[model samples]
Target: MAIFHTSIKTFSRGKGQSAVAAAAYRGGLLLSDFVTGQQHDYRRRSGVVESFCLAPPDAPRWALDPRELWAVAEAAERRKDSTVAREFEVSLPHELSEEQRAHLAFVIADALVGRYGFAVQASIHAPGTPDGLNHHVHILATTRRIGSEGFGEKTRELDVGPSGKVQVQWIREMVAAATNAHLEAAGLTDTIDHRSLAEQARSAIERGDDLAAAALSREPTQHLGKHAAALAGKGVATDKASTNDQIAEENREHYDFLVRKAGLEGKPAPVPGHEPVKRGGRVFNAETAGLPGGLELRGVSGVRLQNLLLSSHGHTPEQAPISLAEKILDALRDVEEISRARADLAMEKIRDALRWAQRQLSSQGETSELRQWVTNAALQVRALKSLIISRARRLLNVKSATRLRHMAEQEWERFNADCPPGSTRYSRSEWTLRRGRRLSVLEKHTAELKAAQERASEGELNAIDADILAKAELLAGLPHPSVSALRIAEPKPVPPDDLGSTRSVPRGPTFH
Candidate 1:
């Protein structure tokens, strides 16, 4: 299958990353950083089919050389926390030939330079694993624009603001479109989507396939970094990746079970223990509660029932009817469970973003202004965490309410079922009245659940947006080197330390 995978990351000194090293590794070359005096040699690396640099039409001819371009980039940056380069890693379809993949990569690279004025050094890598799958390309782009005069100012559109997101979206869509065009020309049947998992699930539901929607609705996993991915590839389990895999597998199993059960009965499968019963006069007790055949009545009280039916299900005692309280309570419990899962996922993402920002701050020499910014960001993260915790507490309440409601509903159903048809204990007219009341309560509860979900989603989006903006501001505040004085210098060796031996010291201080 052709999968859509694209990741954009920056190589910044703030994160202790070197642009020259990044270029060498991706381009499969032996390049030395003159500024840091560190050599990056990856020439022995296999599976790099092709590597080349792309520049704007107005760019100087000298900028076409990857080693020269990256060396200049390293020398141009004076700040300890400067953003050196931007990398776009994209997965190529294994179905495509080596030539086709290379062509696709070049097309994307050309688009990047043309649109963003960035000098792109692209490398098409063949699969390296034993199975020889996962062909991909690495695109290293200069932060500054290149022209006839020299490397101009940094490109802002690809760095921050709403424009940055738009650029990424444009690149992703272009990749998918270009790949599909090639596949279509080759008469291949497979295709890929740039939409997220949630978006895809919603589309599936709109197309009337509830099963497919459910199967696609699992929470998307976090990206595994290079080390974690490598370990996982070697049959080692990682905590986050393993948990996500298990969740995805469970969703698939549940989908399969639902499909098979539906097929056998030629109808929608009912939830276990949710089917209507005919028995009557059964009292609520511990024994009845434990049985799967009917609802349990042990450890239940009227106060608990009222809490579940009236409060948790969004109904008042006067508005709620006793007869259908069980159904409403069950529905409310389901909503709460789903909401809790979503809240937990949102919290995880916020925490991850905070950790990443903190790491960047810790790597660089801090200033007072930077410290203030970090403090503000930390407070925002703490506030978001508190909100999530508050929501979780509410969910705990819902769980308690649901337990009580289940017992009451079960006992009531049994009592009515055991009564004779004409018995006063099971009045048909009263049952009909209660059913109508239950419907009204259910509608109210449904509306509340929908509102709660929307609120949660909004909070998650807001948290992510704020995180991005804060991080961008932090990066923008970092100092940059004066582009006018940048000079391409040769790599120099470091001076050796004297060990009480008669070794001659270098005349001038060597650039370490």
Candidate 2:
């Protein structure tokens, strides 16, 4: 395997306003000594140092004098138990670009927030060398750390104590995450893991070769497997650390039990909670699962509901590779676009079908004239519900262009479906029997999806907007005659005999 290299610099703020200075100093030191895949040290070339520090920039007004900052940084490094602080430069593989380097920094910073509940200040340094290969260095740090009382500046510098151990672990995680994210984004799966350098070193030591172990520890192992193989050539044996073994030792429970408990094995979704009430001959209930507290958190509208669901439950499920929220949001965005497109497609189909019907009738020598066929009123109501859902998805996804299209399609469908039959004048068209029943059902679904999408945005989490949109749209189209009639007149009742009892008898004059 070829080597893949990354440079991660860890810094600590001493006392006072020297935080940025300390950060820059550590950055320069790391840049100087980074392993650039070459045999000779790149820092030895005086030109490298001169060119690095002199790169174009109007230095910050708040920046401390370079001389004073360097003195402060050097003093901190000298305070460490490990006395030597040298900056070694390494040329990274040509595949990495400056943008990629910056992205890498962001990924590390973001992951740190997720794992450690802290955010970091980051910077990327572009490699300046003749190989035409790009090498970028990253600095992972915090502007300040939060304490119970208030925020405080970082006072401790980097060293090999408990804090050092913590920093090392942090570095390992950052490197691993950044590397994986960068490679994945770049569409490269077969790369190296730089985080396991320490583990590999420990393994090599256990194999009875002190020299090989020392070499592996000191030399940057860009590719863990390759590094191990090279060590093996010198009769140094090493084994990949077994995370499963570590977990088993930590927990006495059977592995299977642990897996299930951790939700490694598939777990069924819990049934959502709702209080059902019979209204207009249909079951109705207020959705409680995604709402703030089942009390309906105020100001959260339907437009944002899908995003809310994504925030609460999307990432927790193991079935999704990304966060469930992310998947849902992606799904929602896709579904909204799909639903809108679907409505348009549905229109096209309707137009084609209607046109064919008109032509066929004309060919049959009938003169009734199709006269602008419209969607059934019931279907129109369903379309409105679909439009609302699609619009909600669009808003949640931050895509607003499709909302109008969705609305128009819905209105068109409704106008075609619900207009009264045999109305000769346009004025009477407004009074046609509407499918109040089906519209009501669709309205409910549209409202729910909109609410979910809104919650997702508030939580700043991933949302399955598309999936919810599609499902809600489908529900809106369901036929419901009883509710449909609500808009036009009183709901029709069952015959008294069909009700299993005769409540009243009809009185009429006898023909005899």
Q: Model-by-model lDDT, in order?
A: 0.60, 0.36
TM-score of each: 0.49, 0.29
Candidate 2 displacement at residue 508 in angstroms: 34
Which candidate number would show the highest lDDT if scored against the true structure? 1
lDDT of 1 by residue, 1-512 (tens): 78789989899998999989998988779998998788999998755667888887557766788778999887878899999999999888878754467667776677677667879899877554323457889999998988877788998887777998887777776666556555644667566667687876786678675655665666566677778767875657889778888877776677678768677868564232112221244333222222111111111111322222223224443443432223223323322333343432333333333344445445754344444444444444333334444454344334323332333344345544654357664368865654444444345434544444554465755775565445434433422211111221224445555775455754977696
Per-residue lDDT of candidate 2, residues 333-381 (tens digit):
3333334435532333323333444344446532222221212422332
Candidate 1 is scored at a TM of 0.49
Backbone collision count in every prediction? 6, 55
**Local error of candidate 2 at residue 411 (angstroms):** 62
Error at 23, model 1, angstroms = 0.3
In Å, residue 430's CA in model 1 sits off its true spot by 65
The stretch of ten residues in a row with the least summed lDDT in candidate 2 is: 47-56
